[model samples]
Target chain A: MIENLRDAVVDLVYLVCAVVIILGLKRLSSPRTARSGNKLVAAGLLVAVGVTLLDPHIHWRPANIAVMLIGTVVGAAGSIYLARVVPMTAMPQMVALFNGMGGATAALVAVAEFQRFVASGAVTAGERVSVAFGTTVGSVAFTGSVIAFLKLQELMTGRPVRFPLQIPLNVAVVAGIVAMWAWLLGFAGSSASVWIMFGLALLFGILLVLPVGGADMPVVISVLNSMTGLAAAAAGFVLENQILVVAGALVGASGSLLTILMSRAMNRSLANVLFGAYRTRAAG
Target chain B: MNQEFLLGLYVLILTIFLGFEVISRVPTLLHTPLMSGTNAIHGIVLLGGILVAGTAENPLTLLLGFLGCLFGAGNLFGGIVVTDRMLEMFKKKEPAARQA
Candidate 1:
């Protein structure tokens, strides 16, 4: 009886959280209400996390509880401190840094899930695909955002970094990732293959963002943001979580739309922002 | 292909359209906040981290989960707090202060 009740409560809470998230997004449409909207969304997330702690699936062992407590406290306190202290001039890098952490988290979650699937030795093609997609996309977003942070922070040259045959190199890296994806799903399905794919994806991300000039950081950040959301959604599929699916898709859509809008504001297209890297330098 | 996936698909598709509708109206001035807000939202992956970490059976997965939790928390809190700071800038009104 308690199990059934718990299941029902979980379902109900997830549904409510989804609605609250959507409402929060809606409220963000206007600046006057955006702060409150942010507050509502934060509250909703808090409830979601609290409820997740009660999930029957969680082992709640001392080690597990320790990990959760220590991780959350340190992470939250560090971010809050940085957020409060960072000057307005550094906002772009700040966003990029935080977004990178989110992407890395998504990728790690997918990696953990893949490990579980491998240990069980009963993986399905669909599960493999989701895990592969999440890991690759998340890894790309992670590294890409970090590079963007570096460029924005002026820790590296903000000018577009280009090398001989950069386009071909990137294309080759992408093709390799696709091949690995197929191998993981079709034959090998090993954790080692996943790591290799993860590494390649990271390389691709660096290549993807490295050639863009500093002036175009907004578009680069937007694209990486969308990629992170898509990755989170893929992680959702890997874990079969409805809230992840809904929240991830919502973020993915927002980032994609913002990317388009920002690019349009610059009188450029999405493809141009992403792939037209160094074209101006070459043409000039 | 399964029922769960199909349902997730439906939800995903609907949210995508809803995302477009909701964000289409935000002014350019607030784009940064919007981006950061959504960034914070995706930190929902922290839940995934917690779930995996709570059930991890091996050292690697445990480490991954722990990192996930740490990073996810950073994303969640940092994104929100930063976006709020940005929004607070717009909230300050000069005329009221001048009158005072």
Candidate 2:
């Protein structure tokens, strides 16, 4: 009975958090309510985190607790410092870096799970697929987001970096990675191959995002956000965590929608985001 | 101690924060763009959903993953559309100002 009550309480908290997120998003749609929206989001996140920690299933291992603490400190410090110091022109880059961090965290989580499976000899087919997808998608998001950050910050050139054989090179890399992933799926104990595939995907992501110009930062950011969601969902699958799965899915769907919307805002198509079709003369 | 208490606490805290936000008023310039930008961030949910959907063994999980993807896509697209309209209005004003 106690367990049931606890479960019910947790569910209620989750529902409340979800409502907060929705309300926050709505309020944030206009300048008049943006501040309130931000506050609502912060409150929602706090509630969600608190509830998660209270759950019995979440064993507060010393290492896990320590990691969470470190993450919180770093994240808080970074956000505070950036908000105070970053120029308006560089806001886009800051966003990219933060988004990249999320993707990297998800990727690392997926990689850790893969290591656990290898160490314990408890690998399952489903687990392998999840890890494989997570690693590739997460790596892609991480690298792509970093490149975007660099581009936005002008650390890298904003102009599309296209070579004579760039398209073919990109296609080849993608094909190779896909083939390797397929092989990894079929072969049970190919850890090295799996890592290699992830590396390739990372490279592909960089290559893919690098050729895009600054005018497309909005679209790039949106697309990368979607990638991060997908990465999180993949991580959820690897861990078999229901909350992670749901949260990840929500992020992914929302990110994709945002990406599409961003494209339309610029009078560009999704195809343009994929193929580097749009060109701004001023960018040159 | 109970869900009600927790919920009440949340509401109280939220109210305080909202009040402060309204007073500061610095984030006004950022309202529309930030909303559109952050909404795009939510699109990450789709990526997560896709990953989840691919790996989920159970039917329930798969369903949730799909839903996540759907909602995320909607947000992404909707945000962009709104932003586009806002930009168009700005562009129109530029031309009108030139004529004046």
Candidate 3:
């Protein structure tokens, strides 16, 4: 009874934070509230983080505490460095890099959880499905986001990189990843298949973004952000964390809406952003 | 299907409409800044990474978690700072500067 009450209290904390986050997003409709909105979201995040760490299930051992402390210090330092020095012109790529970071974290969580289940020898098929979804989408978002960053930074030309068999190759890679994912979910909990699936996903992300011109990066970035959010949400399900699930879903929704706004601003459609079929008609 | 899933779904759907309706009203000139500002919110994953790390005992899992936290923090801070800087540009200039 006491344990149940504790769980309820923790969840209640998460609920409050979630509401604050939504209110933060809603406040973004005007520039006047935008700064405060950012602060509100940050405060919500603090609450969420505080409660998650406080959960009794986490067992914050010496090593765990050590690791988190060092990571936070390192993370804080890097963030400050980037925020201080990176010019506004390079902002898109910076944003892409950040989105990619979120994806990588989600992918790592999925991978770590799967490893745990495998060690216990109780990995279920349903769990495999969630792992497959999380790994595939998260991997794609990570690599796709990196490519976007490179393009925006002018490390690569902005024009769509095409090859003699671009479409055929992309289709083949997609099929290969899907097949591997199915195998992992349906056959057995083989690490080999999972690795192959992850590799194919990385390849797919590169191929997917390679054919899009630089002018379409805002939409690309937002779409990729949305996918990353969905991936995180899937990871949350696999981990059974209420806060992760809600926050990830919220990001997914907001990212999608932001993508739509971006596409409209560009006077292009979603299909056009993804396929570049309407490139000339829309831009010229 | 499950209770947890149902709860997540409800939040997801509600957010979809709320996000769409709210952002739809912003002017186009502010679109880029708006997107940049929201970018920091995704850093919530940093907390998730820390949770994973907290439960994980092994070095490898811990390493991955550490890296994840690092990246998420970088993303979060970079996003907020950049957004703040961009929004500053939109401030109404001194009328004297405009005339001059």
Candidate 4:
């Protein structure tokens, strides 16, 4: 019963963290409370991470420890130093880069799982579906986020880069990726095909985010955040990890809702975000 | 020492330091953007939650993960909306000041 009690404590901690997140979010809605709110949220995350480490099933393998160390150092350094050093004008681009990195990490994790499945020859249909979804979403988020970073940084033009037959080209690439995914599902061990599809989707992500202008960055950021959540959810499915799926779905849904709200704030429609078609008649 | 414990302690100290810095240098001009930028940082919570959830194999883990994502997303959206409103206010003030 001691183990049971431990589990209960962990659950309680998780619940408290969740509540903290809610309160933190509420406080963040106004400038007056933003600082405290940020602290609360960070505390919630800490609690969540702490409880996760208590799970007996979690193995502290060397690779895991190394990865965690690297992430911690890099994240701390970035937030402490780079965040302050960067100018305000570049904030949006920095956000884009971080969001993209999140997506890329999820995709890489999913790919690793797929490789394990292939090597073991124990792949199932459900696993295949999860792999395909994760790969596609992750690839899309990674590439799209990078393009967003470029546009915000002025490395690329903010104007939509529409070439002749642009729509057709995008459609064709999407189709090719989909077809490749289908083939991978059936073949069950075709790494090359999967990688190819990943490449194509990455290209699609870049193309998709490129044409969007600076004015729409807020909406784009929100939408891309949703994509990252969805990708994470896909990874959860692939890994058969409940927390991943649940967390991913929550992020995805909330992100979608936020995207809607942001679009509305700008007096634009969701359709506009999907099509990258909103053009402000009044130029700033 | 456990990695999680070390990380937690580090984050706690960092939080205290950053909090102090923010209070001392709370610029009126930066109020809006700072809030928005930090809100975007809250997006990282989603990343953390997902990573933790991806490690879970049980139903409870899934539920917690889902809830964490929801809360994080809410913060992100709410923060953006507030920032936009503030930006609008700033824009209006600029025009009025120009006229004066």
Candidate 5:
């Protein structure tokens, strides 16, 4: 009876968080309530994390606890410092960098889960698919956001970077990635295949963002932001966590809408923004 | 599919629609803040990191979990702070406050 009660309480808490998050996002639509809305969402997230710590399955390893504490403190403090110091002109870059962090987190979780599967030697097909989906999408979002950050920060040329037969090269990379994915799932089933696929996906992410002009960064960032959300959702599937899926899917929806709006503002189609196929104006 | 997976699918589908319906109503002027705000939401992956790290037994898995937590915290906290700062600019500042 106690066990069942505990489970019911946990499920109820997750459902409440989900509802709060949705209402918070709703409040963000207007400027008047935006700040408070953001805070409300943050509060919801804090409660979710608190409850997760109390989950029965968590191991109480001293080293693991120490690492989490230290990492979180330093990371949070550093991020606040960065946020305070960045100029308003650099806001887009800041968004891209932070979005990259989310993607990196998802990728790390997926990779760690994969390692666990390898260690246990008793993996199911569904688990394999979830892990693969998480890793590939997370890796792409991570590198893609980083490249967008670099472009926006003026560390690299923001012009459409087209070399000889760039389209063909990208096609070849995609084909290679698909083959590796099949190999990992079907025949090889080895750790080496996983790492190789990760590397290729990272490369593909860079290639995907490099060709878009800097002016299209808002669209790029939105797409990457959405990709990160999808990756987080995949992590949810891997972990079988309901709240993660709810939060991730919400972000995915928000980002997709923003991407469409941004593309419309630029008078470009989403495909044009993504594919670099649009005509460029002569330098004024 | 199993019951759990089916339940998860339902949750996912509902949230997606809920997200679209809410966000599409936001004005264009607030898109940047909206992006950053949603960016913070995805930081829920921090929970996943904590779970993985807490359960990890080996050094490699622990390292991955540590990095995940670090990055997730950065995203979670940084995103909110940045968005708040951006929205701060949109606030109506009093001329008297500036004079003081």
Candidate 6:
């Protein structure tokens, strides 16, 4: 009875977090309520995380806690400084980098989950498909966002990094990704294959984003955000976790809308944003 | 096909519409801040990172989990903070400054 009650409480808490998150997103539509909405979303995350820490299945130890604590501190302090110190002109780059972090997390989870499967001998075909897909998308978001960040920061040129072979190279990388996906789904893929997929996807992300100039960055970042959300959603499918699914879906939805709105605001089409490198006049 | 997968699909379909409806009305001036805000929402994937990290035993798995937690935390903190900062600037209507 106690065990069932505890499980019920956990599930209920996750639902609460999910609802609060939705409310937060609803409030975020207007500028006036946006900060408070952020607070609400943060509150929901806090609750969800607090509850997760109490789960019996998690093997918490001092070392693990230490790792988490250090990460939290660095992330929190670094952002607090970014908010305070970084000028307004650089906001988009900061956003891109932060979005990349989310993608990296999803990719990391996919890898970790696969390692677990390898260890336990419980690997299933569907599970492999989801992991392979999630990790590829996640890797794309990670590397692509980094490239976006570099350009926005002026660490790299904001102009299209065009070369004669750019299109064909990108096509080949993408074809490689598709082939690897098939291999994984066919149950013939090994860990080596998964890593290869990850590398190729990252390369594909770079190739895709490299040719777009700075003027297209807002739309590019927003699209990447949607990709990260989809990767997270794929990760949820891999894990079969309800809260992960809900959270991922919420991000995916909002990110896609934002991408559309950003492109419209720039008066560019999706195809233009993706491939219109010949139009140098579009650079801001 | 499976029940859970179908349920997830249902959730996904509903949320996509919900997102479109909620975001369509936001003004252009607020677009940047709003994008930053949604960026924060996705940071909830940090929960997955924490879970994976906590359960990890092998060296590679542990390293991956640690990096995931780091990245996820960075996303959550940095995204919200930057959005709040951007929103703060938006609230300050300058009397004579040019657009951002």
Against the true structure, whose lDDT is highest? 1
lDDT of 5 by residue, A147-171 (tens): 9999999999988787777778899
Error of 3 at A139 (Å): 1.5
- Residues B1-100, candidate 1, lDDT per residue (tens digit)? 5787777788889989988888888888778888988888888888888888888887888899899899989988898898888777777754568889
Stronger candidate by TM-score (5 vs 6): 5
Residue range with the least summed lDDT across 10 consecutive positions in model 4 chain A: A275-284
Put down candidate 4 lDDT per residue, A1-284, tens digits, no spaces.
77688767765776576567556645544455655665676576556655755655443654444444444444444443544556656766655665666566556556556655676686776677767776788778778978887888888888777666777889899999888887987766476776787788888898787667777876787677767767766775665543345445545655555566567667888667656442432232
Model 5: chain B TM-score vs. truth? 0.89
Candidate 3 residue lDDT tens string, B1-100: 5575566567657766666665667777767777776676767777767777788778887887777677766666666677777766666444557989
Interface RMSD, every prediction, one decimal place: 1.0, 13.1, 2.0, 12.9, 1.0, 1.8
As for candidate 3, its clashing pairs are none
Fill in the DockQ of model 5: 0.76
- Every candidate's DockQ is 0.79, 0.06, 0.58, 0.05, 0.76, 0.63
Model 2's lDDT to the true fold?
Answer: 0.58
Model 5, span B1-100: residue lDDT tens: 4577677788889888888998887888888898988998898898888888888898988888889888998898898899888888877453557888
Chain B TM-score for the candidates in order? 0.89, 0.62, 0.86, 0.65, 0.89, 0.87
Q: How do the residues A1-284 of candidate 2 rate in per-residue lDDT, one tens digit apiece?
A: 77778867876886677667656655655555655565565466456545754454433544344434444444445444653466545656655665665566566556555655776676776777777877888778778888988988888898877766776888899998888777778767467867787789889889978778877876887687767766766776665544345445555655565566567667889777666532433255
Q: Against the hidden reference, what TM-scores do the models get? A: 0.96, 0.69, 0.90, 0.68, 0.93, 0.92
Ranking 1 against 2 by lDDT, winner: 1
Judge candidate 5 at residue A84 and give its lDDT.
91
lDDT by residue for model 3 (A133-199), tens: 8788888989999999999999998988877777789889988987887788767858777778878
Give the 10-residue window scoring lowest on summed lDDT in candidate 5 chain B: B89-98
**Which one wins on DockQ?**
1
Candidate 6 regions exceeding 4 Å error are A1-5, A278-284, B1-3, B94-100
A44-65 per-residue lDDT for model 1 (tens digits): 7777777877777788788888
Best by TM-score: 1
